[model samples]
Target: MPGERLTQQERQRIATGLAGGLSYAEIARRLDRPTSTISREIGRNGGPRGYRPQQAHQATVQRARRETPASARAAGAPLGAAGEEIVELAVRTGLPRMTARVHVDLLLSEDGRRTAAELTRRLRVSPASVSVAVNYLVQYGYARRERDPRRRRDVYVVDDDALYHSVMLSTRHTLESARAAMAAAEASGADSPVGRRLAKSGAFLERVSLEMMESADRWRALLA
Candidate 1:
């Protein structure tokens, strides 16, 4: 559903929806499509003000005809084998694909830092995409942003305690899950067989997470 092409009828409906001042999400809901599909269609097809469904459809046809070479085009410079592997691992750890790539790029940088523009140029993606990815990294405590006085630009720097923060994040989730399980156990009558199993599992997870947090804080203090 996500990757499917928009039908001509859908394009016409999108045009009508846009004319009716409907939001992308609303239009997407009407069409049973992802909001991103609507946004991208409008963005690439002369934007909201100039979007012409027929022209856009024709353009899509032409683009598809020319896509073989475009698909084979290298995504700028390769991130190197190790960097690529790390990016994949980061994605597996729940980071979004673009966010993981940006994080890995920062991690592989000389000083674990890069500006939004630098990221855009290196990643060969739009500035908005870089902004979103870096914002996510900063939000998760994986990185921080600082102003470069001379350049008058913000630079994203991977946190020196990123690993420690990562451990804490993992522990926090485990602890929360344990609490949820315990709550469910209580609701189901803790003396019941299933409730007892839930309680035991919850207790184990809770204890282990607390121990990990304590050890991590001690290690962090030692490193400091």
Candidate 2:
């Protein structure tokens, strides 16, 4: 069922299931499909609130037709091991696979900028899917959105300081958590075993935050 396409009947069933307030997992169980399939189907079309079976079915068909040739071409031009490793690293650093793949694709592109349509054709994904991935990239500071003056389409530009921003965000979160932990430890009395453990954790996180800041400064200096 790896490459299975949902039938119109199945789409109707999914719409009905959503109307009846069934969870995605329950709907998937009824259809003998994976929950991710159900989730993707719903996500691609209007979500649970606005999903329409007929519309969803038609959209799916159109997407399949559009992507068929592109997918075939992509298969012939595989991303080498290095590209795959970049995607894997992004995933390990907390990006979803699709988002990470999109990020890496942008990073590898010659100009580091692409329109949604271009990304859709290159990645063999729907415009909606590319939009979702690009939105994620933009939100996390990995990419920026700009309007093309000559065209109506929006373009996504990869940020050169993407990794630095991501690390800085993480470092700030760690420092905040450490501060909260220290406050909790103090409130619980410093003599208690739980308080001592919390203090240790907070100290470690603080050190990590400091080290991250120092590293970021060094990298920024090199860039300058």
Q: Tell me, by lDDT, which candidate is best.
A: 1
Off by over 4 Å in 1: 1-76, 221-224
Which of the numbered candidates is closest to the native, going by highest TM-score? 1
lDDT of 2 by residue, 31-144 (tens): 779999999999989999999978887787667546657554354233456776886565444455567667877888898998888878877777877777888678657788
The parts of candidate 2 lying over 4 Å away from their true place are 1-78
Number of clashing pairs per prediction, in order: 0, 0
CA RMSD, predictions in order: 13.8, 13.6
Report residue 36 deviation for candidate 1 (angstroms).
Answer: 15
lDDT of each: 0.74, 0.73
Whole-structure CA lDDT of model 1: 0.74
